[model samples]
Target: MLVRTFGWSFAITVAGLAFAGVLWGWQGLAVVAILSVLEISLSFDNAVINAGILRKLNAFWQKIFLTVGVLIAVFGMRLVFPVVIVAITAKIGPIEAVKVAVNDPDRYQHLVTSAHPAIAAFGGVFLLMIFLDFLFEDRDLHWLAWLERPLAKVGKLDTLSVIVALVALLVTATTVATSVPLQGGGTADKSATVLLAGVAGLVTYLVVGGVSGFFEGRLEEDGDEAAADADGAEETAPARRGGASALGLAGKAAFFMFLYLEVIDASFSFDGVIGAFAITNDIFMMALGLGIGAMYIRSLTVFLVRKGTLDDYVYLEHGAHYAIGALAVILLVTIKHEVNEVVTGLVGVVLILASFLSSVVRNRRLGEGSEQLEEQAEIPSGV
Candidate 1:
C-alpha cells in the first residue's frame, strides 16, 4: 500500500533531482533534496488536516485533488505565487519579477522577505481561525479533555472563534506590528497593513467556510430525503468506501470543498515559500523541491483516508489542530523576529508523535476493559 501510494512521488523525485543535478550540479541536487525534506517536515500536520477534509470527497474529486490540485500546489503556489507576491510588493510587472528572480535572485529574495509582514498576518489569522474552530467545537472525543471541555462550553456562544481571532489580531497589530524595525533605518509602523491583511484573512476564511458549509448542508438534506425514500436499503459502494458521510461530497459541495482546501494549502505554503530563500534563491530549485514534498503529502493524505487512519487514531486530528495553532502563533511572532524552520518542523512532528502514542495507550486500555468484561460474561452467575 505504501509503495503503491508513493510510487509517483518517487518517480518525480528522481526526475526532479536529475534535472537539478544536470543544470547546477551537486549543489543544486543537494539543495533540492534539503528543501524537499524541509517541506515534508513542516507540512506533516497539513497532510493530516487535508486527509480529514479529503475523505469527505468522492473518488472523482479525490483524483482531481491529486492531479489538478497538485499542479496548483507546485507551479502555482511554489513558483508563480512567489513571483506574484514579489511583483505586487516590489511594485514591478510580472515579467520584471520573473527576470529579477532569475537574474538577480538576491534582490528577489529581499523583495519576498520584505513582504513577510503581510503574508504572516494573512496566513496567521487564517490558520488561527481553523485552529480556533476546531478547538472550540463540541465533539464526542476529546484528546485534551481538561482544556477542550471548557472550550466546548464556551463555544456555545455564537461567533466566539471569530471574536477571539479578531481580538488577537487587534492586540498583535497594536503591539508587535507597530514595533517592527525596517532594514534601512527606524522602526516602521506596520499596524495598518497588519490589520488590513488580518481582516482579509478573516473574511476569506468566513466566506469559503460558510459557502462550503452551505453546500454541504444542502447535500446532507438531499441525502436524508433520499434515505427516507429508500425503504432501508443497503449503503452504496461509494458511501461504504469513503465513509466520511452517508453520501460523499460531489458536484457543488465538492467544488467548494476543493476551493477551501486550496486556500488552506496557500495559507500553509506562505511561510515555506519565504523560508526557502534561506536555502537557495533559485526559484526553480525551490519549486522542484517543494513540489516533490507536496506530492508526497498528497499521497500520504490518500493513504490515511484509504486505511481509515483517522478513525483508528482519533487524537490525530486534535494534535494536528494544536500544531496549527502553534504555527499560527509562530507566524505572528515572526512578523518581527526570525524563526528557524527546524523549530517549526520539530513542533509539528513532536505533537503528532505524542498524539499517536496517546491513541495507542487509549486503545490498550479499551482492549483490557473489553477483555475483563468478556471474562465476567463467560463465568457462570453461581460460579
Candidate 2:
C-alpha cells in the first residue's frame, strides 16, 4: 500500500533533486532539501485535513485531486500565487513581476514580505475559521473534552466562530503601527490592510464552506452538527465513506469539494510562500523545492485514505484541527511579531503526535473491553 501510494512521488523526488542539481549544483540541492523540509513540516496539518475530506470524495475526484489538483497545488499556489501577489501589491504587470523574480529576487522577496501583514490577516482568519468551525460544531469524540464540550455548547449560536475571529482580528489591528505601501503610491494603514484582508478571508470561508456544505447529504456526515446529537448516538455515528449519499448529486458535490480543497491548499500555502524567502529569493528554486514537498504531502494524503488511517486513528482529525487552530493564532500574531518557522512546525508536531498516541490508547482499551464482554457472554449463567 505504501509503495503503491507513493510510487510516483518517489520518482518525482528523484527527478526534482536531480534537476535542481543540474541547474544550480550542490547548493541548489541543499536549498531544495531545506525548503522541502520546511514546507513538509509547516503543512502536515494540511495533509490530515486533506485526507479527511479526500475520503469523502469518489475515486474519480480522488484522481483529479492527485493529478490536476497537484498542478494547482504546486504551480498555482507555490509559483503563480506569489507572483500574482507581488504584481497586485506592487502595481507591476505580470511580466514585470516575472522579470523581478528572475533578475532581482531580493527586491521581489522584500515586496512579498512587506505584504505579509495582509497575508497573515487573510490566511490567519481563514484557517482560524476552519479550526473554530470544527471545534465549535457538535462532535461526539472530544480530544480535549473539558474545553471542547463547552465550546460545542456555545456553538449553538451560529456566528460564534466568526465573532471570535473578528475579535481576534480587531485586536491584531491595535498592535500594528507601520504602514505598508500600496501599489499606487498612497500607503495603506497597516491596521486597515490587516482588517480588510482578514475580512476578505472571512468572506471567502463563508462562500466556499457554504457551497461545500450545501450539497452535503446526511446528518452523520456533519461533524460540526454532532454536538446537537445525543451522547449515546455520537459514538455510533459512523463517518460516511467516499461519496456517500450522492444518490445523484455526486458530480455537484465533487465539484464543490474540489473547489473547497483548492481554497484550503491556497490558505495553507500563504505562510510557506512568504517563509520561503527566508531560505532563498530565487522564485524557481523555491517553487521547485516547495512543489516537491507539496507532492509528498498530496501523496501522503492519498496514503492515509488508502490505508484507512482516518478510521483507524480516530482522534487524529481532532488533533489536526487543533494544530490548525494553533497555526491560525500564530499567523495572526506574526503581524505584531517575528516567529520562527521551526517553532510553528514544532507546535503542530507536538499536537498531532499527542493526538495520535491518545488514539492508540483509546483503541487498545476499546478492544480489550470488547473482548471481556465477549468472554463474559460465552460463560453460562450458572458458572
Candidate 3:
C-alpha cells in the first residue's frame, strides 16, 4: 500500500527535477531540491496535523488530495499566489508583474520583501488564533482539563476566537495605516488588503471548522449505530484495504475531512510562500521550488494516514498542534522583524523530533510500570 501510494510521488519528483534541470539547468534543480527538503523539514508538523484530518476522509477525497490538490499547491499557490501578491501590492498587471520579475529579479525581490510585514501580520495572527483555539478547547484527554473546563464553559471558544480575530484585525489595520514608508517607498494602501486577508482567514477557519465540529459531534452522538455499521462493513471488507464508507451521513464526514485538509494545507503553506521571498524573486523559480516542496508535504500527509502512524504514535498529533502553536507565535513576531526561513524550518524539525522522542520515552515508562505491576501480582497479595 505504501509503495503504491508513494510511487506517483517518486515519479513526479524525478520528472519535476528533470524538467527543472532542462528549464533552469543543474543549478536550479539543486536549489529547488534543497528548498524542497527545507520545506518538508519545516512542515513535518503539518503532515501530522494533516494525518488527523485525512483519516476521516473517504478514498475519493484522499485521491483528490494526492492528485488535484498537488496542482493547487504547486501551481495555484506557489505560482499564482505570488503573481497575485505582486499585482495587488505593486498596482501592476499580473502579466507585467511577471515580466518585471523575469526581467529584473532584484527589483522583484525588493517588491516581495516590501510586502513581508503585512504578510507576516496576516499569517501570524491567523495562526495564533488557531493555536489558542486548539489549546483552550475541551478535548477528552486534555492534561489540564481543570483549566480547559472553565474556559470552555465561560461561553463558546468560537465566540472568543472571533473576538480575538477582530482585535487582531483592528490592530493590524491601525499599524499598517499609521506606519509611514514601509521598507521600500512603495506607497501601496496595505491597510485594506491586510484587513481583507485577516477577515478571509478568520471566516475560512470558522465556516470550515465549525461545520466539521458540528458533524463530528453528531457522529459521536450516534456512536453506537455508527460503530455497529463500521464493524459490519469491516467484516465484509478486505483486511489490509482502506476503509471509509460513503454511506449516508458518512458523506458529511468526507466533506468535513476535505474542508479540514484544505484549511490545514493553507496554514502549512503560509510560511513556505512567505519564505520563498528570501530564495528568489522570479515568481517562476519561487513557485517551482515551493510547489515541489508542497507536493512532498502532501505525499507525506497521505503516507502518514495510510500507515496509521497517528494511531500508533498517539502523541504525535498533540506534538504537531503544540508545534503549530509555536510556529504561530514565531510568525507573529516576524511581523516587525526578519525571521529566517532556515530558522523556522529548524525550529519545527527540532520540536517535532523532541516530541516524538518524548512519546517514545513515555510509552517505554508505561510498559515498565505495567511489567512491574504484573510481577507484583505474581508475587502474592500479602507479600
| Model number with the top TM-score | 1
lDDT of 2 by residue, 69-169 (tens): 99999999999988988999899999999999899887898788878888999999999999999999898888889999999999999999999999988
Candidate 2 has what TM-score? Answer: 0.89
Q: Candidate 3: which stretches are off by over 4 Å?
A: 92-94, 142-158, 168-181, 185-193, 219-246, 380-383
> TM-scores of the models, in the given order?
0.95, 0.89, 0.82
Q: Which parts of model 1 are misplaced by more than 4 Å?
A: 232-249
Q: In model 2, which regions exceed 4 Å deviation?
A: 177-189, 218-248
lDDT (10s digit) by residue, model 3, range 118-171: 665556666666766866576665424566567666536457867866886677
lDDT of each: 0.91, 0.86, 0.71
| Clash totals for all candidate models | 0, 3, 0
> Which 10-residue span in candidate 2 carries the lowest summed lDDT?
237-246
Ranking by lDDT: 1, 2, 3
Q: Write the residue-wise lDDT of candidate 1 on 244-324 in tens digits.
A: 453555488999999999999999898788789889998999999999999998999999999999989989999999999
After best superposition, candidate 3 residue 186: deviation in angstroms? 9.2
As for lDDT, the candidate ahead, 1 or 2, is 1
